[model samples]
Target: MDRHDELAARFEARRGRLRAIAHRMLGSARDADDAVQEAWLRLSRAGGAGIGNLTAWLTTVVSRVCLDMLRARTAHPEEPYGDDLPERAAGAGPEEEAVLADSVGLALLVVLETPSPAERVAVVLHDLFGVPFDRVAAITDRSLPAAKKLASRARHKVRGTPAVPAAEQDRHREVVEAFLAAARGGDLDALLGLLAEDVVRRADPATLPPGVAAELRGARAVAEGTVLLRERARFAAPALVDGRVGLVVAPRGQLRYVLRVTVEGDRVTAYEVVAGPARLRGLKLAVLDVPAADWAPDAPEGSPSSW
Candidate 1:
């Protein structure tokens, strides 16, 4: 084969790995593709001349690209999540894209957005991808010790201890999961069954329909109100909101709303739909039950059931 073809084939082999790294770092599929494409362009220009380790070289290139993109995002704090850029998978078809999007888990994406760009890069590289700390330092332009500390602080923030006891959290998670399922399916009966007689649902004004009130009371009203937004339920997923079981609406990896729910016994007594960006930033988000090891690229083959 031609030299160009040969290089393309080799890069394609590692594209999936590189794409995973960028996607997790940027928390957006389209941005990940942009980052990976940039890496390929740089490699093509350099022509693999002096790189002894193509894999490491490409990883550094992609990661540096992601770090720059993340820093740009942080600088523009008012950047809206509803950008016009269409979400795209690296090369996956529609079905594959859906699976890829779902597997990443909205919970992790929410938490990943919390850390500073440098800390995000440090932790994602060392902890998730198992890149050595020395290499992480090089990619992030930090001292070795500084790189390690960045990862440590980022990890702590990402996996803060759940506020509820293990048993209680599990119980709450079960109820919340069921509620999401019911809402997604538009099963009014099931939603009513899980809600208390006097259940209340308060939502941000930006989240409601034109005529719908900001606050809904009574189980019938709350359950009916929830079904009205079942379309959004398609993108909703169970997550830990402020150390408790809740839901996050992240359509195509962009977080839009969070459901802060309160459970009394087996029923959902109250829930507040938070859609304001300021409120979302204040939330302490963490992955529910699922550990980082499950989705980390360095995880053992069979252990990556989610990724």
Candidate 2:
């Protein structure tokens, strides 16, 4: 192949990895593609003669581009780029389904949106992608210690403390996951099976349909209520709501509701859906302790599995 063909071939080899970094950092597929294209443009201009490590150089360029996009997004929230995952899934063709299957979970993406641009770079580079702290520092233009601190802060925000012990938390997570699945599928019998006889569901006035009661009691009432929201439940995912196994309804990585659940003996006893902006701001958000392999780039595509 000619020199230009060789260069294009090499760039294509690393494009997926570069796009992954941008996607995690920006949480918008379109923005991720734009960042990757910008990196390619710069790489073509600079050529590979002076670069000792092409992968590292390309990563740095894409990261910098993503950081700029994030800052601009924060400054201009009016022009949001993240499309609602539920809406996309609803209308998704096979190719789109495969892409969604390969992407990070919506809940994790929502948690990532909380960090600053610098901190996000640190977390995405060091924590998620396993880049060394020194490389992360260079990417964020900070000292080693500063970069570590940023990663530390972002890590805490993304992985908040669980209220229960590890074993207990795992048990509750399974129950909550099942509950979410049942709710999403609109399986009233399954929902009733997971809920306690005296189960109570309290929701913010804003979350309920007009004239619907804010609080629902009894397994039958709560189960039916949950089934009614099967459409909204498409965006719900298991997450750490103030250090417990609960759920969050985030459409397109934007937090809308936090469900504080009380699980007892494999059944949901009660849950409160907090939707007010003030309440959501006060509650800490975190991703569940799912295996990192689930989000790996090589994970099976077209698997529309739950998060």
* lDDT of candidate 2 over 31-54, digit per residue (tens): 788999999899888877788777
Positional deviation of residue 273's Cα in model 2 after best superposition, in angstroms: 2.2
CA lDDT of each prediction against the hidden true structure: 0.79, 0.77
Candidate 1 deviant stretches above 4 angstroms: 79-105, 252-254, 297-307
Question: Which structure among the candidates has the greatest TM-score?
Answer: 1
> Lowest summed-lDDT stretch of 10 residues in model 2?
298-307
Worst 10 residues of 1 by lDDT: 298-307
RMSD of each: 4.2, 5.6
What stretches of model 2 exceed 4 Å from their correct place? 1-6, 44-52, 76-86, 89-107, 112-114, 292-296, 299-307
lDDT of 1 by residue, 1-307 (tens): 9888888897887898888888878767678899999999999998888887777888899999999987887787543332122434356554453344345534556777777888988887776677888888999999999999999988787885778899999899889988987887789999999999999999888777688899999999999999997766666667788888888777655678889999978999999988777788889777776655566653222122211
